[model samples]
Target: MTMHLALSALLAIVLAWAGLLNLAAPAFVRAEFEKWGYPPALRVLVGLMELCAAVLLLWPNGQRLGALIGGLVLLGVVASLLRTREWLRLEYPLVLLAAVALVALV
Candidate 1:
């Protein structure tokens, strides 16, 4: 249980940070989004979804739902990276997806 909580906290923190970056519309994020053929507005939407997932993960009763959402989000990211042929970028989301799945199982 302790390990599970620790992993959950870690994932939540990472996602929250990423979400903030997306919401802030940093230059790097904007460039990356453009490279991925996504509109600037999509960054805010993704950020909001990530933030909600982080919140759900932090809430004791919402862990499962959070894990599910987080996993789905990462899955989408993986798909996008694959579609764009960004092989190098797929690693992070794949790892996160695994973590999210583990958290969901726990």
Candidate 2:
């Protein structure tokens, strides 16, 4: 497969996994959201959005839109990390944002 396709697939998988975690709201997920001071319901909403983006990414003609949505979601993640001053943990989401941006562009 081409690089674009490979990257898209990878991102989709990552997003889907994350979406599942958020939807599941296990102890860590619940605690993390609580620590972030966000409303409890927001986690479910984000999860649904992430899953939608993943589905779109996997769609034959929806990669661009999926990338856009994923990028936006990652942007929010990065912003939250920065706001929370979680410097060490910020790298992963920043990398995801960059990957999503690249997917959107290419």
Candidate 3:
């Protein structure tokens, strides 16, 4: 595969695997997210949302929705990071934005 394809593949696996992990073990990840100041409900919501996004991402026609959801996720993360005064963490959102852009471009 070309580098771009490889990257997409890796991203796909990461997202898909995360979706499964979230759905299968929300409480476990929720604990980690709680340390980051997110509530259990928020963690579960994020996990469920991620699971949906992952399904959308895997669907050929659902790319648009996935990208949109991903962008929104990035925005939400950025907002939280900003509120926490963690400008250094901006890269995470930027990366997600880049992922959305890349997926759209593809």
Q: Considering every candidate listed, which one attains the maximal lDDT?
A: 1
1 versus 2: better TM-score goes to: 2
**Each candidate's lDDT (Cα)?**
0.89, 0.88, 0.68
Candidate 2 residue spans exceeding 4 A from truth: none
Estimated TM-score for each candidate: 0.93, 0.96, 0.69
Which digits, one per residue and each the tens of the lDDT, describe model 1 over residues 27-77?
Answer: 998998898889978889899888988999998899899889888778878
Report the Cα lDDT for candidate 3: 0.68
Write the residue-wise lDDT of candidate 2 on 11-74 in tens digits: 9999999999999999999998898898878899888889988998888699989998888888
Error of 1 at 60 (Å): 1.3
lDDT of 3 at 37: 82
Candidate 1: TM-score? 0.93
In angstroms, the error of model 2 at 83 is: 0.8
Task: Predict model 2's lDDT versus the native.
Answer: 0.88
Q: In model 1, where do residues sit more than 4 Å from their true spots?
A: none
The alpha-carbon deviation from the true structure for residue 48 of candidate 1, after best TM-score superposition, in angstroms, is 0.6
Q: After superposition, how far is residue 21 of candidate 2 from its true place, in Å?
A: 0.3
